[model samples]
Target chain A: MKTCYINGTGCISTQNTFETDFLSEVTINNTENVIYANQPSYKEFIAPAASRRMAKGVKMGIAASSKALKDANLTMPEAIIIGTGMGCVEDSEKFLKSILDNKEEFLTPTSFIQSTHNTVGGQIALGLQCKGYNFTYVNGAVSFETALLDAKMQIENDEVESILVGGIDETGTYTLSLHKLINLVKSEEDKPYSVLNSNSKGIVHSEGAGFFVLENEKKESSYALVEAVSLQSSLETEEVSDFIANFLEANNLKISDIDAIVLGNNGDVEFDDYYDISNSLFKNTPQVYYKHLSGEYNTASAFGFWIAANIIKNQDIPEVVSMNALKKEAYSTILLYNQYRGKDHSLIVLKKC
Target chain B: MEALKQELKGKIIEVLNLEDIAVEEINDNDALFGDGLGLDSIDALELIVLLDKDYGIKLTDPKAGKTIFQSVETMATYITDNRTK
Candidate 1:
């Protein structure tokens, strides 16, 4: 079996991820319950004519994927896979609004055509003229992990030499309001929002896109090796410890073998207990968390994945994302755990190349 | 006729989302497809809907759009003759 290496990564998050170094300039925003992605100019990656009808999610995906491919020094990939939770939702809202306002008449085809969940994958393929096996996964919070697993399996089996995988989710006006009404978004009273040790019941909602290029061979640009990925639909708070143990065991690893652990603690008082269990289990390991920087989104785990990749590549972890005061002599093997509202649990292991 | 042509240019620009293209850049004789304004089949469908919604011109034959949408001059003429609203 061939090894799957993360050759390149591109991330667009609430922080200045796209244009800056690895978490060089970090801001902890607890004031607003909802945050927006720090958008980079798309003119460099997408043509104006082609981008006129694209939604924010689509533009971000294109830009991030372009950066990932360029960073990997590959112009084309044999496959393109995307994982998006909401998936071009702004266009979905626009199309729905036009239907309601115009009495289902005079509806333009642009918004309706761009509203599909596979729009990002299709658009990326179109831009690259890549007619390869393009797929999009929409399995809630595990969407990104699912896509990563698919690409990893294909590369391991020698099905493809290189693949582009990404996870994208964007905030829409109507959808954000609906989430707020349902109390999925943190209330104003929960100001000074912190992802760690927060008493809030809801999340600080945000949007972002992260893309990576995976190849079969390790190169100088390789960031890390994808060791394994595990997904579960649901897990109880008590079962969390055993879950990580069993996963590491399957990968011939133990808790002590992990150098650092990237946790998905989104500060939801009700569900963060899952991380608490792992926190105690890996108390001595270097701990890292990113939701406070990226906010809570379905594919926010992708941002966490990006952070882990950079940590392995740079051989140093940014202090801004450090959850504990612990330090590691070397980050050889790292584990990533993410869940949302106590469901769609995922565990991914990455290692230095 | 001049006012209608200018109106057609503006509407086409707005509806098609030609953000980089200005109204002054589009001449009445410029082709709306292929070599001229570079409009595609998708843009053609949008123009069809625009005609129906704004000018009350429902084109029964899709083949006629090839000629009717040749230029701003052609579209203005077609709307002037066929507009029911």
Candidate 2:
């Protein structure tokens, strides 16, 4: 079986991830219930005419995918797979508003055309002029993991030598208000929000895009190997430990085999117990968490994936993301577990190349 | 006529999202597609919607767009003759 290696990664998050080194310029924002992505200028990667019609999500996808492809030194990939929970939602909001404002008459097509969930994947494929396999997964929190698993399986099966896989989501004003109404976003009373051990019930919502170039052969720029990925649609807080352990066992690993654990603790007081449950299992292992910097979104775990890959490649953990004082001499095998609102649980294992 | 032409330029710029091009840069006779403005078929659709929504002018014959949208000058003239709003 062929091995799938993560050779390049590009992430645009609430932190300065696209321009800065791996977690070099990181800040913890606790004042706002909704955080926006720290977007880099797209003039270098996208033309003005092309980008004028694109929503923030599509632009982020293009910029991140460009950086990933460039980092991999690849001009074209055999496949482009993307995952987005709320794809081009800004455009969706605009189109919907237009329908109401115009009474569904004389509606323009630009926003409507760009509002689909597959726009990111289609736009990336159009930009690359790559007519290969292009697919977008939109399964809520497990979206990115589903795309990652698809790419890994294709690489293992020798169906494709290289693939560009990514997860992208963007915020919209109306959507944020809706999420806030449902108490999915932390209330203003819960300001000074922190991901770990927080007294809040809702997450600090945000948006971002993370892209990776996966290939069959390990190269000099290879970060880590895609060892395994497992997803569960629903699991009780108590079942998380066994879910993780069974995943590790299927991959011939144990809790001790994990050099570090990246936990998705978004400070949602109700759902974070899922991580706490796993925390008890890997108490002694070096722990890492990133929602404090990236904020909580459906594809926020893609940022976690980027962090885990960097840890394995650089063999160094940023002090900002460290969850525990426990340290490892070298991070060889890293496990990433993420879920949203106690559902769509995912476990991904990455190993040193 | 000049005011209408200027208004057409502003509307085109706003509707097409031509951020880099100012109204003054777009000559009255400059082509809206192909070599001049570099707009594609998608932009063409936007222009059609703009004409219908703003001027209340519906170009039922799609072939008329090729001549009417040849330039801002042509679009302004067409609107001048056919505008209901």
Candidate 3:
């Protein structure tokens, strides 16, 4: 199969990813249990009237995708693929609240129409006037990985040359409340939360949108070569080593071939072990973790992917993201592994273009 | 009748989330959609709910909204004739 090239990338996260230099000036925001995205000026990217109806997720996706296309110099792609855990959640809450508030009498359609999981994809297509194959995946943490795999497969098959793929999620008031009540979010008193060495029961929840433009051919701004991607719906924490070994072996690589390892460590005591147990297999390898900077969300791994690609493109891993003192002679190939709560584990390998 | 029209403008602005538009700017006979206020189908649905919720008027057919929601004058006239609460 031909290699899938990451021609462009854009990220809007809790750390001013949209307008900053790759964590150069990142200030950890542990003051809140739930962090909001560091937003760009939406008026520059969207019309005021159009933006008024958009939830943060949709707006972020639009801005990110637009920036990605401009960075890749692509006006329109052949396909648009999106992955999201909870889609248009603000609209979902609004629609549901109206249903209850009026006793099912006077519900409006604006929020209802925007609440669909595919709204981001559909709206992007509408904006671009690109009437091509579009899809949205919503399989929990693996949602973004699923879209990435599909885009990769399509590019490898030569069915499409260029594609827009993104993973986006937004916070909703009611949704956050539910997560807090269920202990899925870090406790209120857990502010100043440290993602690496925490005794917390849950992660600091946040929101973000990460988008990438993938093409069959590498461009001047191409970030990396997407060598391989793998997903496992369920895996015992003990089985992670063999799972990675098989993936690396299939790609004609080995554990030593990996330059850096990006692990999803969100400081949930129960699940940080998923990342910690892998430490033995990659003990000598330079390890990196980004949830500390990006915050823990379903598609936050997409931010990890952005970081990995940038690491390969620039050949320097920011000290802010390093999990340990280990270093490589030249940061060439990067392997990113992410999962949530012992499920939806995905492995993606990226090599310098 | 004039008071109802003025009240409808405020209600429309509040319900539809038209933050940029002021009540004084909307003429009683001006169109509520397309060329006038630039409202769309979605806003029409919101107004449908507003009519039902605030005036006890039920509109099951969406096409009926095209006539009743033509302007603040028409909406106020409809509410004065059919209001239940």
Candidate 4:
């Protein structure tokens, strides 16, 4: 089986991650319960005529994919696959509200046309004029990881040498209001959110798009060799330590072998313990987390993946991302573990090239 | 005619969520698609809704919008001609 390598990556998030030297001017958002992406100059990445029909999610996906392709020095990929949890919610909300508010009297097809979950992936393929394999997964939190796994399978089977994969989510107005009503949003009293804190009941909801170009060949910009990636639908907090141990062991790795461990801790009191258990297991290792910067979403784990890829490429862990003060002498092998709402557990192991 | 054109631009901006754009930015003779205002297939749909919702015009085929929505002037003319309400 051929090893898969991430050649290029692009992110559009609450931060200005699309512009050149974007990471230099990072803002740590602590107040807002719902944050939207600091958008890119879509006109640069997309033609105005083509962008008119794209929903925010589709626009974000296309821009991110275009940036990824440019970074990877590739024009088009052999396949396009994407993962989105609440796909095209803005368009969906528009359509549904129009039906209710107008009594279905004279509805048009814009929202309904763009509301499909696969629209982003379909739009990307159409923009690239790529007719190869296309797929979109809507399995909540595991959506992006499922896309990665499918891309890996294709690479191993030699079905495609290069693939464009992404995870994207966009904030919708009424749906976000519904989330707020359910206390999915942090209450006013829940100000100054901290991911490691134990007092929180829910996360600070945010949205972003992260895209990567995965190829069979290792290049100069290859972040890391994708050692292995595994996903589980359910697991108890107690099972997490052993889960990591077995996952590492299966890959012929030990806890001590992991130079740095990147975790996904969304600050929810109920579910953050999953990270706590795994943190205890790798407490001595160089530990890091990024949801505070990326914020929490179904596909926010993609941000963590982006962080892991950068750490492996730069061979230096960003001090801003460290959950603990412990530092590693040489950042080599990294393990990224993330789960959402006590489900969709994922383990991604990466090794420096 | 001028009122209808301004109304059409307003509805288009509102329905499309052109947060960065203003009504005055759209000229009546500006091409609604392509290089004029840079709208695409999706914006066409949103404008299609604007026709139905505001002017009581229902166009079943999106292709019919090509000529009808070429410009604000064209859209206003079509709505004036075919509006049911």
Candidate 5:
């Protein structure tokens, strides 16, 4: 298989991620258990008429894709692939509520139209006018990884030179309430949450959009080469360490070879132990966690990918994202691992040029 | 007639979520779509619901809105002429 490289990346997350630097201006979110993305000025990236009906996820995806294209210095991609676990939840909730509230009489089409899972990808293709191979994945937490694997496969097979890949999820009022009722969100009193050591029942739920431009050819703005990507639907918490080790070994790498490790620690009391196992295994190596800054959403691992790519390219790790005091020398071969509710575990290996 | 036009403008603004636009900015004779107030298809759907809910007018065919929703004047005339209530 041919090598695939990350040419450009963009993110809009709970923290100030749209900017160039990562983890610089982010505030340690203590209050407000439901974290919201520090939104980019949508008017700058989207025309008012097109944006009027878009849910938050669509806007974030489009804006992030636009930035990725601009940074990659490419106008059009051969394909656009998107992954969204809870696609357009706000629009879904709005339409459903209206249907139930008004007995389905005076409901409008805007919410219904935007409620589809592929709205973001469709709107992006509409904006770019590129009717290329478009696909959207919605397999719970593995949604983004599924998209990544597809993009990688396409690149290796010489199906397309460039592809726009991304993941996005927006907060929904009723949906959040339901998750809270199901104990999916941290309780109200667990306001100041910590990921490393937390006595909590749920994750600090948040929303974000992370997009990347992947190409077969390395360019000036290329961050790193995507060596490998693998996903497991279910793995015992005890077996996670060996699973990661085997994944790294398949890519011709050892645990010691990884310059840095980025873990998805979403502050979930029951499930965060997955990340904890990996952290304990890689204790001596430089470790980083981003769910605190990006908040914990289904596709938030896309933000971790963005962070790893940036770290590889810039060779700088902001203090805010550091899980420990350890610093690295000449960052290279960064590994990213993420999962949600102990499902959809994924491992990605990136190498600096 | 003046009261009806004012009410229509406010309803249009509220239904469409035209956040930055003001009610006074929409004139009774100015085009509601395209070049005048610059509304689109989605806004037209919202208007369809608005007509149904506010004035007891139901437009089963969306194509009818091209002329009915052309402007505040046009919408008011259609509502006054065809309102079920």
Candidate 6:
């Protein structure tokens, strides 16, 4: 199989991941029950005419993808694939609300037309005039992982030399309110929800977009090499360790071969133990986590992927992203593992190019 | 007629999110669809909603929208003659 190299990455999240160096400041734990992304200036990247009709989700996706393509010095990729859990959710909410409020009369088509899972990918393709392979994955937490896996396979099989892949989601007030009603969002009383240690039963839900360019050839600007990626639908808490062990064995690697382990601990007291399984297994390895900074969403793991890629390239873990006191002199190999409520388990390994 | 044109301009700027364009930039006879104001089919839909929601004017045929939404002056004239609210 051919190796896939990370050409570039652009992320817009609850933290300053856009144009900022790997986070250097201490992260402020948000106290709100439902958080929102720390958005960048869309006008800087998107033309006013093109942006007028776009929902927040599409704007974020376009901005992030543009940044990634520019960073890679790529004018256009051969394919564009995007992963979104609730695509153009704000538009969806607006269209649905309009239908109900207006009794389905005098309704406009702008929001309705943009409220699909593939809208992001379609918009990007339209912008670039790229007609190659285009697809969107919306498989819950594994949405981003599926996109990543697809890009990797296409590169391995020589179907495309370069591809732009992204995971995007935007939170709407109505949806967050519904999530709060079902206790899927952290309670308001849980002031300053901590991802590592919290008594909260739910997550401090937020939204973001993370985009990357993957290529078959490594360049001087390459961030890291994609070593391997594995995904599982569900896993018992007891099976977490063996699942990881088997993944490592399949790659002919041992537990100690990993330089650092990134865990997805989102402060959901009920399910945080899922990280404990991997944490204990790699007890001596440097531990890293970023959900405390990015917040929780279906595709939030993409932000974690950004953190891991940066770590391998920089050879220094941001002080704010550490889950354990352990430190590494040089991070050459990084492993990322994430799951949402014990489902959509994903493990990705990366090494410095 | 001028007042109605100004009101329509403000609504277009607000409804369509024309962040950079000011009210004065759009003239009364500036074509709203093509090269004059550079609006498109999506903006046409938004204008249709603006007509119904704000002026109580109902437009059913998408083709009829071409003449009614030709310019700010035309839209204002149609709204003045046809609005129910």
Candidate 1 chain B worst ten-residue window by lDDT: B13-22
> DockQ of each candidate's interface versus the true one?
0.83, 0.80, 0.70, 0.46, 0.74, 0.71
Per-prediction fnat values? 0.89, 0.74, 0.68, 0.58, 0.74, 0.79
lDDT of 5 by residue, A1-353 (tens): 67788998889997777984665677788676788888889998888878877889999999999999998999999999999999999999999999998997899888899999999999999999998999999988889989999999999889999999999999999999999999888887886787778888788889999999999999999999888899999988998989998897788898889888989988888888888755477888788888878778889889999989989998977777888778888888998999888789999989997
Give the lDDT of residue A230 in candidate 6.
Answer: 97
For model 2, the DockQ equals 0.80
Q: Model 1 in CAPRI terms: which quality?
A: high
Candidate 4 structure quality by residue, lDDT tens digits, B1-85:
8888888788887777676679999988999888887777767767776777777788887688899989989988988899987
Tens digit of lDDT per residue, candidate 2, span A191-262?
788888798799999999999999999999999999999999999988888898889899999888999999
Clashing pairs in 1: A30-A193
Candidate 5, RMSD to the unseen true structure: 1.7
Point out the worst 10-residue segment of candidate 5 chain A by lDDT.
A20-29
lDDT of 4 by residue, A254-325 (tens): 888999998999888888889875447787988888888888888998888888988888878777787888
TM-score top scorer: 2
| Interface RMSD (Cα, Å) for model 5 | 1.2
Residue A181 CA displacement from its true place in model 2, Å: 1.2
**Candidate 1, residue B22: how far the Cα is off, in Å:** 3.0
DockQ of 6: 0.71
lDDT of 6 at A21: 72
* Poorly placed runs, candidate 6 (over 4 Å): B1-3, B60-64
List candidate 1 segments past 4 Å from native.
B1-3
What's the lDDT for residue A156 in model 1? Answer: 98
Point out where model 2 deviates above 4 Å. Answer: none
Interface root mean square deviation per prediction: 0.7, 0.8, 1.1, 3.0, 1.2, 1.5
User: Who is ahead in DockQ, 2 or 6?
Assistant: 2
Residue pairs in collision within model 3: none
**On DockQ, who's better, 5 or 6?**
5
Q: Could you give the CAPRI-style class of model 3?
A: medium
